[model samples]
Target: MTRSPATPLPPPKARRRLRETAALTQTQLADRVGVTPGTVRAWESGRTTPRGRKREAYAKLLKTLAEEAAVQAPEPEPKPKLEPESRPQPQPEAKPQPEPEPKVEPEGKPQPQPDSQPQPQPVAAPEPVALTPAQAFDALYAFSAPALVRQTFLLTGRREQARESVERAFQTAWEHWPEVARDRDPVGWVRATAYEYALSPWQRLRPRHRHPEPPPADPGDRTLLNALLRLPPRHRRTLVLYDGVGLDLPETAAETEASTPATANRLLRAREAVAGRLPALADPQVLHRRLAELASNERLRAAEPPTVRRGGERRARLRTRAAIAFTVALVATTALTVRTAPTHYEPPVSPGQAVRGVPQRVAPGALSDEELELRQKLLDQMQDGPERLSPRLE
Candidate 1:
């Protein structure tokens, strides 16, 4: 019997590992394969499988990319040498000063020595205590609110909208504290939600209110942030999620509602765009450091914890119930009004007379010639109305 063909490797694991090994982002791999980033994510997610020619092509491209990466990889740079003077040389000691002569004590009374003051010991800061779920949500809101607001501002390019989005997102978290507390990254969820809310078109429909001006951006961040803002919204969001927010590829993908491959592609494109606009960002280390600094600055500027009340969910439920009750009441009242209110007046028919299709008896009275003539005229007018117009020929 002929030897069987070797079993093919599973696409999801193989794709992920190969892409990572090659240091190629999902977007980069997609570019090479001429497929959408989502397609690559699907491949890695096992949502779909490659087959026949596509499978062969995928395997071949992965191998080629991996090999190319290996070939082009740079050797580690040597550490810089330290100069002798720069190596922390010891300073020479000064000669001891001549000692002062001791004064003799007078007569019989013992001389009292000078009283020494005790030095104050340095106090260490207390470590933060672990918080309960409710406490944690409050702390998270206090610490994260400003950063989230700033991030939203960057995304929305409007201070008022950003604040609204952040507030809405936090309120949502507050109302569902248990669920939010259980989330692996509550801050990330909040940030992602705020970003989504900021971008929603419905927000534009809300009544506008005057808001205080937002704080100024850091001088260092201004140029880079402006350049980032110039990118397409998707690209900007991806970059912020990855570098600014410090989310992993998968997390960023989920937050952005994109497939892993698509997210990767957006991140790659975002970086490229930013690098094109700001040459310093072309160096990954420099870019990472800058993003870290920006994130740190935002954290440092977070508002102090304020008193927070619980029962946000209860309040929301109450509001919902109130709205529903009001609607029902309004509907009932309108229905009652419609039922009881007097309708347009209609003439009372005689007992022997017919009104529409209902027969009634008429009163015994003889009709005058003028009355008959008036009735004929009224009938003539009804028959001569617009509906009796003849159709015009073209």
Candidate 2:
């Protein structure tokens, strides 16, 4: 015989009331109580009763449902009232008054008047001092941009790129002269600016260039220093800032926009990358000496004045501009003359023509039309031959 399906427990009195107040269907009540719709209907119709613990739980559920229903139901609104009527009154008349006369003072005596408050005059503000680029450079130089740059390079391991970033930082500081000049620590502002500039996209866009070879005169310092310089600019920046410049972990992290732990990890890895390649740098004193050399070298100095005659310089500049314009116009005219000049034509070369040739550098007006055509055709064939001609040849 097949086994009969087990009977579901009956719903309790509280569950029946909860289901009615909740406006839940028999199926909804059955699903919540873990019973069937038929069982919920049978219990609500008083044909069955729920057992022990389920009965107690159902009572608590009914109480919560009733409370929810009470909160959600809307209250009855108040009724409107009728208005009362009013009575009318009387009108009043107008009255006129005479004009007052001006008073005359007795001989040699002034009339008394109300005390008048004195008005304060506005004060003028002082003018701002204009800063020259040279002055800006000097102020930033004392604060150690070179050391900051070298440190950034050591940290990032990209020397040339880092230097450009540092140069750009100095340029920006120069542009913000008024603010930087007033700072209690101008050097700190410059260093922070340089470090932030290095992290920007403009730094990444700078043309990559060769790192200068370590100064050979310092043989004692060449090994480790050379390897350090050879590393990529960003890594070099990181190492320099953390190890060479003696920045604490948090400061290094701040400049690099990295966590202190990440900064420490980078420092460890950079130290290892250079340790084996340069023996001198392995020694702490050697490393310090190399850093000192770099710090002294990486500074922005004032540019030397251009050589020019002192008196009547304005007239000299105008004369120079005139000469440049005149030269450009002459060259343009010559080009037009040459283009519009008549040209002799030549027929195209025959197939497999065993052409004998002399290779010579042509002066501006040396080549005849046929010669120029032949030379250009030969150049085009050489440059765009085999790799590009396969389909056309077939």
Q: What local lDDT score does residue 197 receive in model 2, on the 0 to 100 scale?
A: 67
Task: For each candidate in the order shown, give its overall lDDT on alpha carbons.
Answer: 0.72, 0.60
Query: In terms of TM-score, which candidate is strongest?
Result: 1
Model 1, 1-394: lDDT tens digits are 9955543644455557677777778788888877888888777755466766667778788777667777888989999999887898788999999955556567755555677799999999999888876677777887788778767766665666776677777777777678678655678768867887887767657666334344437876767767766888888888877777677887677667666778899989988988988887887678878876654554233333332333446568889999999999999999999999889987898678544966678888988999999999888775646555588899
- TM-scores of the candidates are 0.47, 0.34
Question: After best superposition, candidate 2 residue 255: deviation in angstroms?
Answer: 1.0
Lowest summed lDDT across 10 adjacent residues in model 2 is found at 302-311
State the lDDT of candidate 2 residue by residue for 1-394, as single tens digits: 9955433422343445566668876777667767777765555533356666555555455666878978988987978654444334445666666744445577755556657799998988989987675655564554565566565554334555556556655555555667667655566566666666665655445455344433534554444456775665556666776667666665565445444466688777776778777654676567666777754554323222111112124445677899999999999999999998778776788779565686877668678899999998787775645555355554
Q: What is the lDDT of residue 84 in candidate 2?
A: 45
